[model samples]
Target: MMMKKTVCMGLILCGMAFGTTAQTRGSLGQSDPKAKVVLDNVSKKFKSLKSVIANFVLKVEGANNSVSDSKKGSVYLKGAKYKVVMGDQEIISDNKTSWTYAKDVNEVTINNVDQSGNSMTPAKIFTNFYDKDFLYRLNGETTEKGKVLQNIELTPTDKSKTFFKVLVDVDKKNQTLARMKVFEKNGNRYTYEISSFTPNGAVTDDMFTFDAKKHPGVEVVDLR
Candidate 1:
């Protein structure tokens, strides 16, 4: 369940990071201008796209750097709507309502979108959230599979957060996000690798909502 929740949050973060204009509350004292420029380009590239479809792999590693679990998933995003499919869980949101479906139990839970406080909703974590939440600096570039990637290291300003540091890898050639790694205070690391990203993909509005009728014997739990 924790992994599912993390994936859901990561998907929402990715969708928002590229889908909308980011809000900046001014840069921190240690923030690097070079990293900001790279992030700005990424935001511009994503905002110009009509829609996005991405295939990603999630890896969970222990403190000792041993892989404990891994999962492959895909995310579909269009405007404020998104659908994430990973393993037996599917989280669908139409910007207003959300449905979490668990295939193993054949149950789906529905709830209204929460927009209050510091909720991890896309509305709250829109593009360039690092500008508001963390102090970031450029960590230079690295090559992976012949593609040049710009790496940026980020530290949270608020120590109360679960994750203490985040590493972002941007595809320098395309100015798109290629990967992200989150280091938690509890000695756990979560890495998300974007295996493939498709921009301006064809998508339908109906795809952002759950259709209980399609799943026979599936129980519905509405929390709205």
Candidate 2:
């Protein structure tokens, strides 16, 4: 499978690297400081977010002349454990196995840390960002929904399942993440609107486990 297809299953799993202003992108050393500040600051904030729950809306634009579509969903995370539901499509990570459910196809794909190529894990992206395969860039600041945000860009460090540049919107003053955009290699794009953050909430470890009996009719299609 193509890397874009793999990461597309985990939109937020979209990783970061480097870029210039909103208009330009290049090597990390050449990245604009303005964008770098946001990326660096946001990375710090996300690292501090041990657990959170929130809902968001996702919009995806396809490349290859494909059409665009939108999905409304909820994302919940407790440490590395998370669950995201985009309309009928769902993704759940228990920190052990990542289960992605596609209602449209009645399919469930299962993957662990090693087999997942580490690209499907969003938190891992932050943990290994220091790797030399990537660079950083800074854009400018803008206001989105009453919040002052700094726009930062990230590029990939290596060639994997996907290689798409990422744009992260950070809260300039509070050093929080507001949103992100994933530029896919296939010419498709995805934008994430993050809202309703409940920091340091209660999330149990059981939420990450895969229980086919609990989901009942939900088929467990272990792709791995």
Candidate 3:
């Protein structure tokens, strides 16, 4: 009778241990639990960030041995509308009307009225997370420049086409977003590094509005 009681106790303990392990991995692979922890901090930190304008240096490496380019310019993003002025080529997305204007080419490309997840601009990290339906996962972690970071991936449950996967390097200590990597469907990869962040700044809706009349000499060709 003593032997049987001991065996039953061991089996019960094993079953309980297995149940705990399975429940933990149900959220993710249990590799980087801190990734989920950092994402949860986003909404709380930026609740006061309504609109922002920032200057950023961008480096783009296209996958499949495509054209690799580097860009340095200013970005003006207000609410869901934004305009990126890089060289003479301007990208303006007004939520309702998305337009890409190239001065050298003298052509304007118009996007669909209801384009989803099209805005992967750097500013999205500050403003767009307020939406409630984003899905997150802890991909893994890596050490960059001697700083330990957790690679957190986000997939929008509503709409997105900017990339197939987005991997963000989250600071292990401060839980702040350090850098981000985007893998697009066209085999192009974009890596963005945030140097400085100014939260709760002054930004007006007019900053997002694009007026062709402002640039009278530049030709605008609508390619919707």
Candidate 4:
């Protein structure tokens, strides 16, 4: 039938397009030795911390090169648990159950925390994404706002990923992550800048869990 032929042709064309894109993406391998040293130091430092508190600014640039207003936010991390406060939404996770609280709607959506190795949560990126699933290269060092930052480019091993490249800027002086930028194949760029960081910050277990009883008349949507 003509309809069946058309569908077959569409599938073939889609496959061709995907093949072309995959050829242009970077493949995973060992990182540059210089870059490895920096990353290893950072990973060790992060693992040694009991908890961390930090303030960040997020900037999203669209495909057309139009940049959105930078949004300021805060993050609290203790092991796999984390609490992210940005805009009117507060995301809290105890590494088991995750709750997304929308202040505007006075409602919360509960979902199970993704335990997959490939899950790309903010906490995962801040602590462990570079350690696996990526091959990195030292893009050399750059001075940003008068601070020397070591720039590293990470290419995902999985070519099917929406984000093909990630750029991480580490503060050489303190050996801490200062900024990260994710480049998507769709031409969108996400930039996260860490303004301040405090390791071993005071955090209670209760801070990572959401109690609906505290919020009067709050609606809960259990998706888990």
Among the numbered candidates, top TM-score falls to 1
lDDT of 1 by residue, 84-104 (tens): 888778888898898888887
Off by over 4 Å in 4: 1-29
Report every candidate's CA lDDT. Answer: 0.74, 0.62, 0.54, 0.73
For all predicted structures, in order, the TM-scores are 0.85, 0.73, 0.59, 0.83
Residue pairs with backbone overlap in model 3: 110-223, 117-160
Q: Tens-digit lDDT track for model 3 on 1-224? A: 22322321222112111111112333432333455566766544544456555555455776776768665555565566666666665666667776666665555556654455533443446433423434567777788788888777764343334445667776676555566666766787665555545554576666555676866775554546
Q: How many clashes (backbone atoms < 3 Å, residues ≥3 apart in a chain or on different chains) does model 3 have?
A: 2
- Residue 55 error, candidate 2, Å: 1.9
lDDT of 4 at 116: 60
| lDDT tens digits by residue: candidate 2, 1-224 | 22233354555554322221232224335555665555666567777887766666677887874878776776677766777766666678877677877766565778775443434355544433423344556666788678887777766554453545777777677676667787877787777776666666677777666667766577665656
Model 1 scores what on Cα lDDT? Answer: 0.74
Error of 1 at 86 (Å): 0.5
Reference-based TM-score, model 2: 0.73
lDDT of 2: 0.62
- Give the per-residue Cα lDDT of candidate 4 at 63: 87
